[model samples]
Target chain A: GAGVSQTPSNKVTEKGKYVELRCDPISGHTALYWYRQSLGQGPEFLIYFQGTGAADDSGLPNDRFFAVRPEGSVSTLKIQRTERGDSAVYLCASSPTSFPQYFGPGTRLTVL
Target chain B: GIQVEQSPPDLILQEGANSTLRCNFSDSVNNLQWFHQNPWGQLINLFYIPSGTKQNGRLSATTVATERYSLLYISSSQTTDSGVYFCAVPRGSRLTFGEGTQLTVNP
Candidate 1:
């Protein structure tokens, strides 16, 4: 509505547990992106969606890390069998056609 | 896959001082942008410079895309400018961000 918004500002889950982070993009924005940022590092791209289909997923670290933007506005990043290394901040951003993107508050996922 | 590099990995400056940051990309890119991330982790947009130069207030940026590099200049810096500055390039429409320049402005 305002800017991009992500859910569960922080998440703590045990190893092997499953977690899902949500992202709500600005209304009518056609592009959505997911990224992971480890401490002391810049964000690494994970996946990008153009409308409801993923335009490029080559950045996803592994198959266990998956993202979906069904309907093109709201997206979800699902982690299966989470690992401790997966503990990092996940950020979501949305951009209108050819415009710079606006970021969300980010979800800090801590896998224990 | 474009490689983005930012120089002066870390910088410290006093209030009212001026500083410059740089970025070099590995390939031709259609979109380039600068972002500022506060210590609290909020990312704010700065500029989108793919070529030539542009200015906004005390902050200005220049991109020599033909040479695969960009520069960001901050004049009369303030403590409010203390944070990490990032340079990003659009790769096939997705942004690839650099490690960033950590700038600490002293009071």
Candidate 2:
């Protein structure tokens, strides 16, 4: 079976620019999540989606970060006016419901 | 919200050695997981033990929910086992990950 997959394994952009990272979850997974990881640190939760609606998004750092999981299978994390502080590896995971979430390869975003 | 802590922030070992990593949570959790983030930054699921014990190959995990802690054991580790090991527990609808333990296995 196919695991989770993320597009643009690496992305480099200038500060104040916008970038969108995509994630394809495993087949039949009803729950999805997004997280960000800085160097030498663990991943921090960004958003969680149960089905098409975001169940919890408190982890989103600010209003500039938004994520959508339309149709409950694919998700896109959008960063508006990105800042150098946003530079990190963006990770995505999916699960049937919760617990034991399977992770993707992640998209490394670099804000220069 | 729950606080998760990992012990022995950094560890170094020679190939074929065995080691144990621990994770302690401040509150009770219904879910707990262990992951290995490789050099390429891909997080690989190692165990999903919220309680009890389970083993896979040279890796095994045990979670004592009542004690609010989990332990991951790696036996006969190889250089490929060198990476960051993380433990995460669910808080509300999201996971709260610990800072992780950096493991370096030398050949």
Best by lDDT: 2
Model 2 residue runs over 4 Å out of place are none
Best by DockQ: 2
Candidate 1 C-alpha error for residue A92, in Å: 0.5
Task: Predict model 2's lDDT versus the native.
Answer: 0.94
**Looking at model 1 chain B, which ten-residue stretch has the lowest summed lDDT?**
B88-97
Against the unseen true structure, what C-alpha lDDT does each candidate score? Answer: 0.91, 0.94
Interface RMSD, candidates in the order listed: 1.4, 0.8
Q: Which candidate is the best by TM-score?
A: 2
Q: Write the per-residue lDDT of candidate 1 for residues A10-112, one digit (tens) a residue.
A: 9999999999999999999999999888987888888989999999899898889889987879999999999999999999999997458788889999998
- Model 2 over residues B1-107: C-alpha lDDT tens digits? 79999988999999999999999999999989999999999999999887999999999999999999999999999999999999999888788999999999999
For each candidate, report what fraction of the true interface contacts it reproduces. Answer: 0.50, 0.91
After best superposition, candidate 1 residue B103: deviation in angstroms?
0.4
